[model samples]
Target: MDTTEADESIKYTVLDNLLVDGKEPGSWGTFITRSEMYTQAAQMNGLISYLAIYIGFVLVVACAAILSIQQLSNVADGSRSYRVLAQIGCDDRQIRHSVMAQQAVFFLFPLAVGLAHSFVALKVIIELVSIFGNMSIGGTVSLTCAIFLAACGGYFLVTYLMSTGMVRAAIAIRYSE
Candidate 1:
């Protein structure tokens, strides 16, 4: 059946009435209509999207926490190195810049890997979705990318701030000793 020829509004109204009357397959032992099937499919898609977003947020936060802890530990362990750099005429600004750069690489590596995986997975998902209909996924994909980037940027900012403070304190302690 051609979707263009199908009267969706009428079908929606009929389906709505059927749902209101509790005449669905389990409710009244009636066969499910195409309209009802589409409704269920859309609802499931929404649920999955929400679940994915929540999981992505959790992963981003966890990544940031892990990176922050690692950076702080490295600063403590490498305090002697920073003192050596200071002794060699490296200013505090230079030391801070080096620390920030190192943290940036640490934060970006996992994000880059995750994005690579997402690109491949999204390509497969788009192909699978296209089998059902000629839907345009470009907007959805762009939005998802933007959201992920924003989360990553936020985490990077926080990690950089925390690590910078830790590095400064470590350097000061090393110099005092």
Candidate 2:
């Protein structure tokens, strides 16, 4: 038989098998063409990719917020120390620089550790996936890293600004009193 005839025969054969015993075969099984299967797989992959991106966003935001709040609270508790530094001839620039340094440590340490762990995990994932097929994730990794770093940098800048403001306010209160 020609290819067209063979293809029609296979289609009919699948339909016939599915309708066996005339019981509707609803609970027995179902038929799926190769293309249909591939389509479903692609849809699932898209869903999973979206979910991962969403979860990553939530995690990055949560980490940044938590660190920001923690650092702000520390500044609040240490307001008197800042006031003393200002009284002891430290300039505003110096005080702000101090706050910036502290904020950098608080923000970057956890990020560094997380990145290290992620690298190890990704190495393992690459090894496993390589067994199935050759894969190149360089562009995806670079894009994700760039986005993540931008978010972190934004959060860091905001936190530093807020901390400096709090420090200045504390010093002002000291001087006014």
Candidate 3:
């Protein structure tokens, strides 16, 4: 028969060298057991690691956004480079775009490297786990990617907000003069 019927029949059938009577239903009745417990324990560790990495990613993004905001603020506050740029007749829009572009570049560099490293490192780790003759090359990787993309999206949003504030501050300072 099909797998479903064969599997069910095997579960219910007595062994030729019978130990326990197979007439009894499986103990714990579909409930989790010791194996399930260890499996869940391993999964929990992965979840915890994921969460720690997630927190680190958020902190990294926050720091990058803050650094970008501070640099933009310094430029807009008539710093040396600001004076030099104004002498060249670079308008306010140019200044704003320059600030945003710099932020984008800075944010993108570490991000791209981190993403590549995450995928490669995890792939290696999975392979290593299998090579040691213990755990198989199983579990999930796409879950980590999803977490990473969410963090990146949050970073981008924060970058946008910081840029908007800096540009407004620059415009106000420009008008005041």
Candidate 4:
């Protein structure tokens, strides 16, 4: 019989054979074939991955917000220095470049640390998954890294734009005075 027929016919003759003897009695027990177990596991993995991606997106946005706020505050705090630099003949473009450079350095460290942790976590996942059968996570790792980098780039771009706007406003105010 095919798997469908066999699955329909599967019946446990005795509970003792499946469960350890002298165990706590329970009214419910689930028996599934290897194939069924594999299918269920795959489904669970897919669901978990979707949820993880959503959570990651939320975290990336949160990081971007925090960075943007901090950059704006820095502009406020460094207004005098910026004004001095402007008086020293630094154009708005040069000031913007300096601000972006500082922000990039601040962002890069956290990005690197996060990537390292992800790589380590992937390695662990690959090792653990190998217990069941040979599994390759190389492609998965590459794809994940690419997506992460893209997300980071998006966040960086948004933060840079927002920060430069604040700086430009500050510079305009200085020019007015």
Candidate 5:
């Protein structure tokens, strides 16, 4: 076997001593816990937690990918708009604000809608699974909302930087030509 920096061969123990590492599947990030030397189907609602987290990650990434592509297109068109606005009455700050506003709408609309869907879906999941196991609907709901909002905030930040750069470029072109 070609040994790399790390490797662990799976063994046929109860795996209760295992970290839910991807070594185990359906896990990511740094998580470590010792099981009760036994195994269960994760109490249904607990399963729901994992399901929600994974789906949230996937949905966020997919939406970000789409947003990235759409933002590229908008940047191109915004350049023209910014240049023309400059030729008219718009100043640098106004053009920058317009760039920000455009990207804001482009990002915020889908972002809010996606979070709404995630909220409702995760809430339903928690409610549905609570019948089988103890679950904190309120806590998870709030946490999910915060995380979703933060994700959107992060994307917004990135978009802001990119849009600002575009504005600078457009402004520079106007001055040069």
Candidate 6:
């Protein structure tokens, strides 16, 4: 007999013979075919993978937004400092460069720390997963890094541009008076 017939035969035999408290096996427990089990596993894996991707995307966007807001607030508070630098013979280019450098450090320090942490976590994950089978995540890591870098770079650029505008406006207001 083919596998399907064999499976059905076995299933029927088990259901007929296996009894708990004078009831069929279906009443007390669950019964599923092998194919059903595999299908359920696949569906669960897909759901977990999608959730992970979505969470990662949300975190990246949230991090960028928080950093941008913090940087903008600092610029607002330090408007007087930029004005002082301007009055003390620093050109607009020098002032802008100083703001850019400060922001670069501010943004990069957290990123460096996060990357180091991620590397350590990834190493642990790889070790654990290797027990099951050989798995390669090099391409996934590269793609993730590329996407992360692009997102962060875009945020950094926007933050820098906004900060420069604020600085310029602050200086202009002082001069206009």
Which residue runs does candidate 1 get wrong by more than 4 Å? 1-28, 173-177
Please give the lDDT score at residue 131 for candidate 1.
78
Query: What's model 3's overall lDDT?
Result: 0.63
True-structure RMSD for candidate 1: 6.0
Clashing residue pairs in candidate 4 (N, C-alpha, C atoms within 3 angstroms): none
* Tens-digit per-residue lDDT, 1-177, candidate 5: 422211222232334356663365334333223241212445654686679777977788678767866886687776877778888988778877776787788888887787678668777877875765464577867776787677777877877787678767877887898
TM-score to true structure, per model = 0.73, 0.82, 0.52, 0.77, 0.65, 0.79
Clash pairs for candidate 5: none
> Which lDDT tens digits does candidate 4 get at residues 1-177?
997566646634444355555563344555666678878988987798779877887887688678767867887788778778888899888998998898888888888888788889888887876766466656765786688788778878887887777777777788799
How well is each residue in 1-177 modelled by candidate 3, as lDDT tens digits?
975566555555633223445543453244344445677878986797679767866776676667556555654564445445655787867876776677667767777887788778888877886786367644445665676667666766676566656565655555568
Per lDDT, the best of the predicted structures is 6
**Distance from true location, Cα of 108 in model 4, Å:** 0.6
Candidate 2 stretches with Cα past 4 Å from truth are 1-9, 17-27, 130-135
Clashes of each: 0, 0, 0, 0, 0, 0
Ranking by TM-score: 2, 6, 4, 1, 5, 3
Off by over 4 Å in 3: 1-88, 128-140
> Residue 69, candidate 6: how far off, in angstroms?
1.0
For 20-134, candidate 2 gives per-residue lDDT tens digits of 6666655566666555666797688669767986799789989999999999999999999999999899999999989999999999999999889888987787677557536
Query: Top model by TM-score, which number?
Result: 2
**Which segments of model 4 are wrong by more than 4 Å?**
10-28
Better of 1 and 6 by TM-score: 6
Relative to the true structure, candidate 5 reaches a TM of: 0.65
For each candidate, what is the lDDT?
A: 0.77, 0.84, 0.63, 0.76, 0.68, 0.85
| Pairwise lDDT winner, candidates 2 and 3 | 2
